[model samples]
Target: MESHILAISGGGFSVEEKAFIDEYLLKIPRKQEPLKIGFIATASNDAQGYIDEFYTAFKTEQPSHLTSKDFEALNIQEVVNALDIVYVGGGNTQYMLEIWQKTRFDIVLKNAYQNGVILAGISAGAMCWFETCYSENEEEYEEFKGLGILKGSLCPHYNDEQRRIAFDNWATTQKNNILYTLEDNENLHFKNEKVVAKIRT
Candidate 1:
């Protein structure tokens, strides 16, 4: 099974103008009838407003929210296996990774991806899938190691002045590793670890 990942720099359920991106994600899963979708809001600390927005946006499909709390009672593998697509929300990248590691949800996601589940996200959510990610820390941005599901580095929110400047400066210091950048309305589609398409919505 080929793995599919859609990395969005910004905009999604959180913004009304980018709802098309969410629609685009809905069409990626092979199973069209009664599509099963899961949302991971760990990056936002499982914020209720974000989760509510997801439910509202994806009401057409069978959408469920998966939080750190779920790790305590549900079998992570079983939960992930039931879904056709996993949508991750954006927030603090470092904090999300820490929680995912502690709960081993990161391992479950890798297995799910290998099994042909479509992984999609925006901002920090998008950065989590790459080998290295440029993340915001206080007043500045820095590089942070990711899950390595995809090679090279990812810089989200490229349209933002500060983020673009930070990424540009950081790119100069690195000799290897292709740097993938995405704007607020752009997305990069990766299949089997290779970029297959660039989407704009």
Candidate 2:
């Protein structure tokens, strides 16, 4: 069992990025077809629109089952460990971290990775995989603590953010930690806690 994590930068659930995502997920190591993917949408507080988008994006794949793992359920560990892949949705980074911590999902996620589960996400989901995240938590982007499964920090939607012009400034001024930036289509993939490749879009 080894770690496999995908930090997707954009088109998390939108139809527009389906082609890339399909190919991406398809290429990842899987036990079998109709991969079991769990969507952790706690950041969005189990918002229906986000859930709908997640299913719509992966509809053609006909996954074994798509579920919202963060909506709070029984046998949480068993449910998470059983999945082939876990996809996290983006929204309110600050609140998402709070809930995940309170519920011990952070620990569960780390264990899942160790057990060879494929973990993936977008925006806040992407940023959370690192030691730190450069978040736009309150209008302007600022650095925040993260899960640290991967090293350093990450910034999502690099090209689309209004304050992106100051990215270099922000990174240079950070008191500590290196910041990894991501464009809408860029994705980071890791194996056993090490980067195998960065699929640049």
Report the number of the highest-lDDT candidate.
Answer: 1
lDDT of 1 by residue, 24-135 (tens): 8777775649789899999998999999999888888899988898866567798897788999999999888888888888888999898888999888889999888777
lDDT of 2 by residue, 31-114 (tens): 467777777778787887877777777776544333345435667777778888888878878778877887788888888787
Candidate topping TM-score: 1
**Residue pairs whose backbone atoms clash in candidate 2:** none
Candidate 1 wrong stretches, greater than 4 Å: none
Deviation in angstroms for 196 in model 1? 1.3
TM-score of each: 0.95, 0.86
What are the clash counts of all predictions, listed in order?
0, 0
